[model samples]
Target: MSANLQSAANPSLSLKKRILPVWNQLGMLIILVLLCVVLALFAPYFTETNNILNILKQSSITAILAAGMTMVILTGGIDLSVGATLALAGVISVMLSNAGVPAGIAMLTGAAVGYTAGAVNGYFTAVAKLPSFVVTLGSMTYLRGIAFVISGGLPVVLQDKLFIFFGSGSLFGIPTPIYIMAVVYIAMFFVLKYTLFGRHVYAIGGNEEAARLTGIKVERTLIHVYSISGLMAGIAGVVMAGRVISGQPNAGISFELDAIAAVILGGTSFVGGVGRIQGTIIGVLIMAVLGNGLTLLDVDYYWQLIVKGLVIVIAVLLDKLRN
Candidate 1:
């Protein structure tokens, strides 16, 4: 009774020890709701059902990329090559389709290419002891080059009906990409929360040396992490190709930045091992809403870029604060 009374007497101590933590955890969700309310009030069409669905559909690609990125970043690493990988995979998939390959195989091949690229990244970073940033950056450059070379610096139109369905089709009035996003997030949530691999990722991010000492296959886990990242980018690439009905070597430029930003904004520590898949989904939604709202307000494209850059900076600052 005495201790309880003393604790109640110290409001500042209670706030610092209690309230702040809760705020840190929930700040993004609050921000998302507030942003939506403001946008709906200011942008007349923002609350329309069609516009809402469009936001989800358009944001699905980034959300997918961010999901993979969340895993990689949770291990205290980064992959700068995803954008390039998307372009390369998309290009290959389309070219294959044009060459009379079946639609399903072509899509799967694109995803495989992404996985292969990620595995290579994992090899250099995990086995060869190279920094992920340097390794992925090098891959980013070469992959983009390879994409351009293979596509002859031109876009390849995709005509496969089944392939296009994944990108632009809808079922039950919801866009297919949104459904894909849902599956990815649901699967990721389970993986991070309930799987041995997920626990290992967190452990490594917390302390790689300690995890290694404890018999975690640090190298193999990292390789898997990066490979998953690549795979997500590949899937996103296929969806993008389907949406546009073409494979452009230039698709997904700057996507890495957006993914990173979303992850960080969703309250994932940039240092790794202190985030959730649910938080990433909220972050993606915030980003999507911001962009959609700005467009509705008739903001110039250049200004939107500036706004997004500022948001990225703010997200980094928040991560630092959380750390």
Candidate 2:
């Protein structure tokens, strides 16, 4: 029948063939590979193995933060304070380590600090019904100030060699940070694709009222979501501290820009309720590749900042068009 044939030809007839988000990610994948190719051909030393390692190492911190950003953005909410949280956790962890705490416990303490900060954000955002932007924006400044006060405007040098290993060491010839990044992605991918909690996240983002009417416990879920974001920030701060072998209160300034940019580029909607970890990881790589490629071409850091800002604006424009 003609009707049947047309129906079969329509990709939307099957969930697997419907081509919005998935196909978009495919396009991103192609662009990422092409970027690597072009950079390799034109950029000096870019294709070298050691330089490749360096790129990954440099990208690790951004990737880690982007993972958390992905979750917050999925809910049509944002966390501006994550970068500040990084400083707070990093300084606290290092200060503890220097004062004779074990590396593992010190790291846990840092993560807990992040979690607590996230909880505060979530409590106000959900229970108090405040705008996430406002709450996190205020927290961002205060948290950074706290970091400065606690560290006395000095870097906290870490002597825990084991913690340092987490940042710079390798496992089976691969950077440890790479492994940490991979694990986060894998864990997030599994949660988003195969878990009820993940489905709830998507549902909440797509339509908060509808989800609430459907008995989703919107407030509780939001609290958990914000908490998760802080947890990821804390995790990132620990690795960053280890990488630098010191905790600098000034670390992570303007870092939120990169994380949010990566998420948006990866096909996540700012309007809430549509995105995937796969797209996010690809976006992360694209950002990293762009940064790396530009650096290889000897672009000035200020120019890079301009480029990054333009990328965010363009990505946002494209997102609006897509919607």
Candidate 3:
């Protein structure tokens, strides 16, 4: 009788503990909802379905990049070159398509180029013992220069009708880009939760030396994590290019900052080894909401930048307090 009572009581305690961490994930969502409510009250147009879909569509690329960034950060590393890689990938894909290559082939080539860029970052950081921060930061500038040089600082356009569908098509009244984001997130969640690689990532972030001692193949894992980040940035570029029907050489400038902010706001620690995909999703939504709300309120663009910076600082402070 006592054992049965104890077992019943344990469920409630376990539930509470589980619920506590979830509150952080919920924080972004609550703020998003409140922002929407306030915006709708002030701007009647904010309640429109078109406006809502526009916000989701605009956020699609950032969400995709952030999803991969969440994984990279989990391994105690950062990829500052994502934005530059994104621009390069988009420019390359568009150039290929314009040069008589099939749209599909061009897209694949872009993804490959992006993956290669990631591999370079991984090699230097993992094998050469360089800090990821420094390696990616250097690559960020180099890659952006490459993008401009290759495209001659001009935009490239693809006239293929089918290729544009990936950006503009809708399924069951939802944008295709939004659907793509959903698929990516679902796959990422599984990879993070179920794979040996995922376990190794968390282990490495928790303690690289300890993980190495445990034979977790720390170098290889780090390489893979960064490669994934670059690949995802490439994917984002492709989607963005499709949406705009043109690849701008300077597209995705400063996009890495937004992605990193989203990851941190999702409760991922800069110190690493702690994060959740669910939280990332909420963080992405929060960013989308903030941007949308500001636009609806007619807030100055410069002020919006200030607000965003403040939000990131506050999020980091909160994360530090939690730790």
Candidate 4:
């Protein structure tokens, strides 16, 4: 009897150990499902296919931006300027396309501008030894101003059909934005999981001094990470522009907050050195679902913002306790 009990306990204990890390990833999924269940119980329209697809479509831009923000945050850094960079990129891309520039060239130009802005943030943080918060905060203001200056505070309408296709078209009955998000996430997952650069990012986030001792080029990696964040912001800008068919100078306001919220809700530690891409995905889904459910229930938008803020605060508090 004693031997049998020990044997059973051994397997159960081992199983528990294996499942510990997975709990973080599973937590978000469980919450999302619970929320959906509640919403479905209360609101019949919550289960509609169109409503679901709209949630996914609306989440596409934020998902893309959050994917990149995950990499940066995993390294114990944040980019508050992503919202401004996104707006700036959208304005530039649409303006260029309207000026008879080729669609491809206009897109590239926007991405380039975003990259440069990210590089500047990285340089100040990594090379100049400034805090990322201060650097990105300054950038947040400056970049938004730059966008207004460039667009003269006017909205830029895109005339290129190809650009609109990226935003509005469907592939095999799925929205193009959904397809883009899927591709970007897959590629980002591969890079984060398999590449040397990805490993370096983890190492640095895990411990910057230790990573330096391990011969990881800490400064360069920081720069590259910020650049990736900027690039994603640019991609998000393009997607948003496509969706709206116009580039508004004030576009993407407070979007950075949403991206960071998604990252945190996905189980990424603000303290640095711990995060999962899969968790981030679930986090994005939760936000999307919450928004969808609210719309279905006809809840006020202001209440939605308040709820989101509370969720972030709770998540960060829980993260602190876990650490």
Q: Which candidate is the best by lDDT?
A: 1
Q: On TM-score, who's better, 2 or 3?
A: 2
Which one is best on TM-score? 1
Report the Cα lDDT for residue 291, model 1.
Answer: 98
Positional deviation of residue 244's Cα in model 2 after best superposition, in angstroms: 0.5
Error of 3 at 150 (Å): 1.0
Model 3 agreement with the true structure over 173-233: per-residue lDDT tens digits: 9889999899999999999899998889889988999999999999899889889898999
**Least accurate stretch of 10 residues (summed lDDT) in model 1?**
11-20
Q: Give the Cα-based TM-score of candidate 1 against the true structure.
A: 0.97
Candidate 4 residue spans exceeding 4 A from truth: 1-22
Residue pairs clashing, model 2: none
- Candidate 4 lDDT tens digits, 1-323: 87667758799766765677677658778899999999999998888888888889999999998998999999999999999999999999999989999888887888888888899999999999999999999999999999999889989888898888888877787889999899989999999999999999999999999999999999999999999899989888888888899888899998888899898988888978888887888889898898888877888999998988987788788678657
Compared with the true structure, all predictions reach lDDT values of 0.94, 0.88, 0.87, 0.89
Model 3 Cα shift for residue 62 (angstroms): 0.5
Candidates by lDDT, descending order: 1, 4, 2, 3
The 10 consecutive residues of candidate 3 with the worst lDDT sum are 16-25
Candidate 2 C-alpha lDDT tens digits along 15-54: 5445654666687788889999999899968888988888
Error of 3 at 185 (Å): 0.3
Scored by Cα lDDT, where does model 3 land?
0.87
